[model samples]
Target: MKLRTVLGAALAAGLGWLLFAPTRVRPVAWEGPGLPPSRTSGPYADNGRLNTAELLAPVPGLKAPESVAVDAQGRLYSGFEGGAVVRFQPDGTAPEVFADTGGRPLGLRFHPDGNLLIADALRGLLRVGPEGSVQVLATGAEGVPFRFTDDLDVDRAGRFVYFTDASSRYGWPHELLDLLEHGGHGRVLRHDLHTGETVVLARGLNFPNGVTLGPDEAYLLVTETGTARVHRLWLAGERAGTLEVFADSLPGYPDNVRFDGAGTFWVALPSRRSPLLDAGARQPWLRRVIARIAERAHLPLPEESMLVALDLKGRPVAFAQGSGSASYSYITQVLPVGDALILSSLHGQTLARVPLAQVRP
Candidate 1:
């Protein structure tokens, strides 16, 4: 009887380990090399005096504006979780239906040829013509289908489009899992219209949510949202195809990245840094268990709102933040247009544009 009891106990222990052990994720650690200290007290600090009066007035009839793209003609396009693209003219007129994407559209970028390219969570990479017709460019890579097609950027030549796949197991609804799991399920891919080829530029990325081309069009920057960092990929230099950390230790999890005309990159922080998440990142097993349970329960997690600005060389320049109290929601994307910054939220029903001059010196 003693032998049998000991064997049963051993089996139970093994089973528990199998069920609770954290999923093994590749360690993508940044030891502060080429990155500033996590905390700074200079111009980038939160002086608690950011003017958010403009953000109080929201766009009418928009829901969960994930991204905003502006064309050369000053026409603004916003993507929503309802799979609709709404066009807001420059005169603050009512928005009209630009296109019905039939899927959750996350990122919007206009090609040089007057076509709109979209990174859609359900439909994959798509192109919308001038007449509002849609076309699928690519859906899968390396024999694996995309699970969460998130953000994209178009090249100057209008022949290549670069985008991100945020996760393999979840769409936007379960992005918190990507954060807790810390597994490298995200990917950066390129689509070439001339060759009809889709290539995976970088793999094993953790929740790559936003993408943008550099000012010179020589490199691409992608946001690793789960890691609170942005990565750079050389596209034209001798180091072409090489990937490296562009910035790290962001104050919050970055959602979408865009560039301003002044050689600055603006990244939207959907949520503030959670100490619980940071601790889970240090311990793999706990994170996996939390992710599994959260997925099973289908519970909505908490997030914050923030926006950050960085220079061309990936140095933090400015930061504007809001409290996570129930009054405010998560900020998903930021676009710089003229003298205003258009902000998109994943949980709010309207888009917001805050005057740029108010947020910075």
Candidate 2:
């Protein structure tokens, strides 16, 4: 090839990239906090050792099940992308439509009064009783409506419900975009059933994913996905009305946090961060370009089926990993019932029911 012709082609390609590719995403600048080390050894050395083949309770016609609620009768319940809350048998078979939420549901918790409460991303909070009737709970706090209600937990006495609004700038569809922007529009809210009031506990959270009360119900644990940290909001104590980091430097961005009755806090990590994402955190333009490319390529997701079990004091205790031979990924929550840890996935068709005995060392 002639040198002049080669030079002309290169110039034209560069010109095209500068014009078309740069504006594809047009993302705003967001310098995210430097990510922690990829691996933490102390209590997580046994990560990714769980046997995925043993779990996997099948459900027919369920799509993108992400949250689970085990009723008093051992009935398993989950929310699907199609705005339906389903009830399943103990072994995770036999599907029934417990209630049609008519909006995307993301979190499930059973009230002490036998009511199934839900954090619907599009419809705010909801309550479904055994009669199969659905009622709207709290939709907004501080005079503003909830934009992305993510997860919730009822207090031990069922007096209050703590929940998270993942992002006020993004709805259910633009979660990744919100992450890319590093928007701190997330918040933790409390709904008092007695007072019939919804109030904001804390604001400016970075993609807060889940909310659960502390062991004694004196404080709340909130997962900040963009920061890969968990925070505690004290309600009654020396630290009451104060917020502090409960767990920091997580292995990956956390999604949901749950407290098992037996003193374990089960946390779900949807996926491990990539070097590309880290670089994008520094270069906003690069993140936009990467997002466009990923959407177009139908990329194969990097799976890290990682779940961390934290002690009641917010210390790491156990790590349940299923990286090997696990077809399911993007775990959103893990509820410990007896000796089993029921894992819900954001894009999986079946729920995982790994034995706690197998998850621990």
Estimated TM-score per prediction? 0.85, 0.88
Candidate 1, 1-361: lDDT as tens digits:
9999999999998778656655433333322212332434754455442335244234566688788888888888878777888887764356777887899988999999888999989989999988788898888888888889999998777888899989976676677767676668889999898987888999888789899899788899998877778899899879999999998888777889998757899998777676666765556656666655676677454465577888999987888765534323577888888888777788877667777876676
Runs with alpha carbons beyond 4 Å of true place in candidate 1: 1-44, 49-62, 298-302, 324-328
21-71, model 2: which lDDT tens digit per residue?
A: 633344556555465554646565535555463445566677788888899
Residue pairs with colliding backbones in model 1 are: 22-285
**Model 2 lDDT at residue 128:** 91
TM-score, model 1 to reference: 0.85
Q: List RMSD in Å for every model shown.
A: 5.2, 3.1
Pairs with steric clashes in candidate 2: none
